[model samples]
Target: MRFFKYILTLTLFLALTKGYGQDLDKVDRMLSNYPANPSSTEELANRIKNDFSNDLERVRAIYKWIALHVAYDTKALGKPQRVRFSYRTLAELEAKKKQFRKDLALQTLKKRKALCEGYSTLFQNLCQQMNIECEIVPGIARRLISEIDRQNLPSNHAWNAVKINGKWLLVDVTWAAGWVDYSKMKFHQEFSSAYFASDPNEFAMKHLPDDQKWLLTDNINSKAEFASQPIPYKYFLGKNIKLLSPQKGTINMLKSTGVQFNLQNVPADTEIAYHFKREKYGQKVKSFTKADTLSFKIYSELKGKDELVIYFNGEPALGYKVIVK
Candidate 1:
């Protein structure tokens, strides 16, 4: 009788442990089978199994692993030539670029020759392969008014909307995956997870979703009203502060003095403008503020600080090489 009792207990322990082990493996298998891009349809279906192998660890594991596995590519990101690029037709591009044997994510990772379109497309492909639901969103990053070409207007950028924990989270695997510089060439191969389950309010300034419905309670075509033209006064009028205040985490100014307060590594075309919290912005200005070209404030006075975000108008804020000191 005693022997039988011990044997039964051991058997149950072994069975439970074995089941747990299988689940852990299932999660890893789901992620590894597909490319980083979220467009692999068949593979994505298989991954759905992992999302449920262990309900307790499903969300935590998936979110952490993705953010950890992939990285953002800052150096490699920029305006691709104005060719007609489409995400729905990536398989066609792969066929034409180098046959279906090479996927956009794998190729882009190796060569680091991808634009916002390429990055977003690759992410979408990988997510699809893993059965992760995602979509492409277009938005403005900033105006391309540089010495090379001042006439360039606002361009477009793309990212993903993933369903995690029954919530559609905005993620930009392209931006999340930081860039790597290999000699003169760059290799984009680092993945971040914060953007995976990032909040809409936090993500919008940088990654505008393809569907505004992802974040909004109501349907509104907010992008159409998003000013594509350059708003000079916002930044042009502020004074420049040398350093960010210790408590404020903000650098305010009274006039545009050209004192560069690096808005961190915000996306290109993302303007750094903030409105007075007290000011009654009409319906147009109430929900969101205009994207401004961050410049040196003309007058130098540190009165009050404002909240900040990466407003994507043309491209993801992956470009600005100028670092904020």
Candidate 2:
């Protein structure tokens, strides 16, 4: 009788483990079977539902599929030779926006490429069809270090806010797809799921949602606060460095006398360096390292427009554009 009881316990353990294992297996299957070309959205949605039993898993599956499959559209993002907007009035603009959103999903799927708006809309549409709550929040994305000081820029970016297990999560599929090679003006495929369900505070560093509700945190950031926060790039995140400072790279010398920035979690042995106008200026830059935070200061003597390139160790990490009056 004791032997039989032990056997039954072992059987239950095996069954439970397999039940948990099914999620991993399902994800593998879903990813492997992902279509190379466009397919019926409804059919794809049904397949995702049938594969994943839990809402969180479903959301993850969808996010992973899009992040791995979709390519960032460089042609669409490149600056055009001419500026033109067909809609002159608010009513016409609204109509055009409505139609544009309608086409984003289809165009993205067909081409397997998209800008941030298309990526966010595609993610939202997939979530909705799968009975998950998601929203596309349009706002400012300060991706380029040079964009830090620019003003009067329209809402130039969009990202998704998804609710999973009753908690709001932020995701940027467009960025996850890859980063733009600034020199070549081309997109590169670098898959990362770090943006999936990212921390609200960290997400706020780079993305400022037009809607306050999408902040997803109790400590909401005002426009002034957002503008003051340092730009958080993937390099900073990867190095586990927390930035504090001018909140932007493009600083007007007239507005601010000196350029100062703060850093946290910097390694004791890791060397920080800078180059002013491509000339090594490590000795000229003042730095203080204490505990986990490192602060650097560089006095500005700019007569016109120039760039300050920052280096970590020996490699270029970030660049800042300086404008002087």
Candidate 3:
């Protein structure tokens, strides 16, 4: 009887651990083979409604479809066009806003491209049609390492907050769609599910919504604290790495003996390295891994206001500003 109980527990554990991935894979496969190229948001919403019964699955379908099909508009980013609509009454204003959102989504669908606003508005519109509660969250997103520790950043980005099973989950379809290669000035259509239903703590690392209520977590004390966090790349979150030390975005070398990083859940074979902006080649930082935890230290000649980057498996994973007092 005890043996049978132990086996049952192990089976449940395995199922709990692997079920989400299996479900996501099934959804991806189903969507990939879907025949219709939806010409309008209504048609797309209807297809999603018919195909997915659960709220989570329906939202996932909308997110996956938009992330895969839509391209980021690079030209619009440089020269944004604005239109003004005149309305006399509050009801008229509300109606116009609703119509405006629908128009934006349809425009994005027709063009197959959009800015962050377009991505978010389309997601919100589709969620509304599907009877899922969602909101367009406007905020400041720290994209570049140079933006670290900078004061009073302009609200430059927007994402979505979706309510599934009475819980608000965050989604960034704009980022999931792809990244803009600034060097070549091109948008790459690489679909990543990392931003879908991300942890509030992890999402707060780079995104601070204009409204404090949208943060969804009390771990981040204030906007200043959010601004003062190390820039985490998609790889960091994708791999589920935990940054355990130097929590502040800027490190003071003069006050501390040396810079040491304590990370958790790092793969044993992963190579870690770091370099300043002035260095051509990165100096490898030897890490000691024990039970999925890794620790490494950087002892180097450093000076004032240097940009320090940590590389994981030859990819830039984290960025911090180093200050020598």
**What's the TM-score of each model vs. the native?**
0.41, 0.67, 0.88
**Ranking under TM-score, best-scoring first?**
3, 2, 1
Total clashing pairs for each candidate: 63, 0, 0
* Candidate 3 off by > 4 Å: 1-22, 254-257, 290-292
Tens-digit lDDT string for candidate 2 (200-239): 6667767778887887654434776665544555655434
Candidate 3, after superposition: displacement of residue 130 in Å? 1.1
Candidates 1 and 3, the one with greater TM-score? 3
Cα-lDDT of candidate 1: 0.40
Better of 2 and 3 by lDDT: 3
Q: Model 1 residue 284 lDDT?
A: 12
lDDT of 3: 0.82
Which residue pairs in candidate 3 have backbone atoms (N, alpha carbon, C) closer than 3 angstroms, thus clashing?
none
C-alpha positional error of residue 6 in candidate 1 after TM-score superposition, expressed in Å? 56
Q: All candidates: CA RMSD in angstroms?
A: 17.2, 11.5, 6.2
TM-score of 2: 0.67
Using lDDT, rank the candidates from best to worst: 3, 2, 1
lDDT of 1 by residue, 1-325 (tens): 5335434533443343343454544554555554555444334334644555543234334443444444444554553444444555768776565433236555554544465666666555555555566666665443221211122334356666665434454555554555556465565555444454443333432333445565432212355322212222112211121111111223333333322333322344444333233234311111222243233221222334332222233222211111122
